[model samples]
Target: MFIQKKYIINPHFMYMAGQFDRNAKLCTIVTELNRTFIVDKSPLEILNDSIRCIGFDLRGAMETAKFLLGNKYMCPIMVNPIHKICVFPDKSSIHNDVKWFNPVHIARTFSSNQQAMIEFTNGLIITVPMKLYSFNHKLQTADQFRKMMLSIEQDPFSFEKDPRKGA
Candidate 1:
């Protein structure tokens, strides 16, 4: 049995998009098995998974539609049926991608701070943060997240203290 878990860095945290920026929002990070996977799931897939895994029990599909189409919180980074990545850009960098879909419109459509959603080649849809947390700090921050990711990428068994016992 392959155990998978998701770790969300509540976008409300300042460290998500580097330092010296103020735009407290919630960011979600999906960590599964040895890989620190990002969220690339579609809005509809995320909604359904949230309901299925998190037991959201949304009122109904209509309510779900309303929720997704009512708020401009999460910004869609890239969307193509196969994969997508969204990010909540800081106020200064918001204008960088003006040609793509209107950030405001994307946000208004989904009542979530999530900014990215991607679908893996293996049929897994994921969502990820727009800007990754920087690699600096005494406390284990996203840098550690990156390290874990690299470690897994290099030698997945290295990080596992007890592979058989499953810690």
Candidate 2:
């Protein structure tokens, strides 16, 4: 029987609890099971931390901090510029099911479709839907994508959302 290597680590799982750095060519993924894995970035020179290049739901740092602060939670949050990823402090007691996979991969999209594909080092191909975040399937180079990701800033929320908006 030929056993195909299935992904123990999915994209959504990586998004919530992991970080990526294109310059360094690394992705640090944390599984829900509280396991940490560092992988390489290759083939996917077209994929980086660009909002326009790939589909993602991201919370800007300032916005995240405001909400977290309002909740009276004391924790350290930092952004690794080199990695272009937001790093939040992990509380040991919190358990999750996150895992790791080979980071070296290729990302491509069809000119006529709003979807993309990510091919992993293990030859596993993942189809990435691009319309969720309103990305129109525009082709973006690694540098362009990095620039966009770096340029994103969290807009300040109004009093309606944060009671202590100014305070």
Candidate 3:
């Protein structure tokens, strides 16, 4: 007889809380494991600060996400050539009439990750597993993944931020 252990991890309420907070003014990305980066912020400062703090270029991430999402908008990812960073308002907070892109593509891409979770600009949570690239089954009860994400989000220096200033 084979015993399959059930993995149960609680979702991080802080992420959900931050998503609903309209006055949040900062965002940060912390790497918990080898290739995972957890995005957390007040939804106001996430776009800009994540680029500054995380080594991965925001332009690349945005372009990747945009391309993956199949956004019809031709707007370049970076408005400022020098800064190479885009600071647009969180799309999730906008009214339905203002939304121009489909998040299904983005969500699908996230669902393809080997082990990943993406908190969209609109507060949607997407969780992906390593073996999911071939099998696209959506795992709704991912407690360990949520716990790992929350752990990284709460720790500022998990990704190597300055310990003195406190990220």
Candidate 4:
């Protein structure tokens, strides 16, 4: 059984959820942020069964949408789908690609700081503050999250009994 989980992902940072299809080994992430020009969507199927990394230019989300429409790919069901494009320029030099990795190999950095890092099995690391993670039940601090994830590293099925009570 797949246990659904919810995460806040930070107030400013967009809420992103990734869905992976093991048979095809593909991942599709749908994200929603406060950026003016960005449109939030549900998981995209076009992004699946593709390469390890899929890059996107927010400025071109419209174009991407058109491409998906033309190809008969379903449009993602977004929470707040309508928004203005950001007028402020993005200066980050990072490529906007959605990379897929096995969840079993994912690990987190042990830190007391507000920010936390998740190291993927492929060695790709993404950092977000601890407050971003939302819980359906009890909350966990950054330190506690580190410990919980560490325990999972030791036994992946440890949480099978009760996912709400982290190992």
Candidate 5:
């Protein structure tokens, strides 16, 4: 366990959960490579800082997600598209309690007691207080967003042509 005044997200980052400490003070739990970082900032702030630290803006990422997927809310963001670093939130970032999870770091997810249980690649499991269906939907949405971004990056100008047409 360690305390960090500011955090820059990296490939090893697993998730960022906004939570209240023992004193009921707002803080964020950042998990990276099985290391815990108790950040004195909200999840949104941490995300924005990380993005900006890498020369990207939070709004640009959100807008891109929305434009690509037509998502109105809770859209996943690709913090660094070149590195394929994408993450999605279970709820609105402004919400007092929200968790931003990187899909790449997640090993699996299961439903139990109507809630969603996340299993990290490191074998850590934690239950989230949200409907399993909703959680799964969010995860799928994030996956979709990531795929779209990757496809675009791989061939932004390439287009599919029918062989029968003989282009």
Candidate 6:
């Protein structure tokens, strides 16, 4: 119902896709915990801005994820590790039809005809144009990525160097 000029991807943001309608071309469809709105920017634009807001750019986020997930395609991006807002794209990021989803808020995904259906924790259901098996694989990867990040951060031995940087 509401059209926003810009948006940041946060914990409340469930998923965002580039939707084409009469009023807008490839506008971002942002679904949050409390509501869904339309953003004038494209999905990638929103993602880039969101990551930059937290002191990094989209390429940096993707490259870090790719490095950690070597040989794994469709890597899940950890936008804000402290906030636990990680997301994975359905298609390649260069594709205009890509849809980014945060698996944390996803209740479940099931097959519907030749596509997949995602049920959000907030009871929002949307069909994705992807095979059930493929969708599930991506979801599992995102889960794994999130777990790995949390484990590394929460490790008991994690500590900064005691001595001064120059010393």
Candidate 4 wrong stretches, greater than 4 Å? 1-41, 44-102, 131-167
lDDT, candidate 6, 99-164, per-residue tens: 899999999999879899999999999999989999999999999988877876798367333354
TM-score (C-alpha) between model 3 and the true structure: 0.23
Top model number, lDDT: 6
Each prediction's TM-score versus the true structure: 0.19, 0.25, 0.23, 0.23, 0.87, 0.87
Q: State the TM-score for model 6.
A: 0.87
Cα lDDT of model 5 by residue, 1-167, tens digit: 68888887888999889888888878899988768889988888887887897798999989877776664688999888767889998888778888899999889899898889999999989899898888889888888888888988899876344455443
Candidate 6: lDDT of 150?
80
lDDT of 3 by residue, 1-167 (tens): 12112111111111211222234533222221122232334332333444445455555745643543244232223322223222221123332211111122223335333555554444555453335432232222122222333454577356443455433
RMSD of each: 18.4, 14.3, 17.4, 18.8, 5.0, 5.8
Which lDDT tens digits does candidate 1 get at residues 48-117? 4444443343235334222333433322222111112122233322332211121211221111254444
TM-score, model 2 to reference: 0.25
**C-alpha positional error of residue 42 in candidate 6 after TM-score superposition, expressed in Å:** 1.2
Q: Give me the runs in candidate 3 sitting further than 4 Å from their true place.
A: 1-41, 57-60, 72-167
In model 5, how many backbone clashes occur?
Answer: 0
Residue 62 CA displacement from its true place in model 6, Å = 0.7
lDDT of each: 0.29, 0.31, 0.31, 0.30, 0.85, 0.86
Span of 10 residues, lowest total lDDT, candidate 6:
158-167
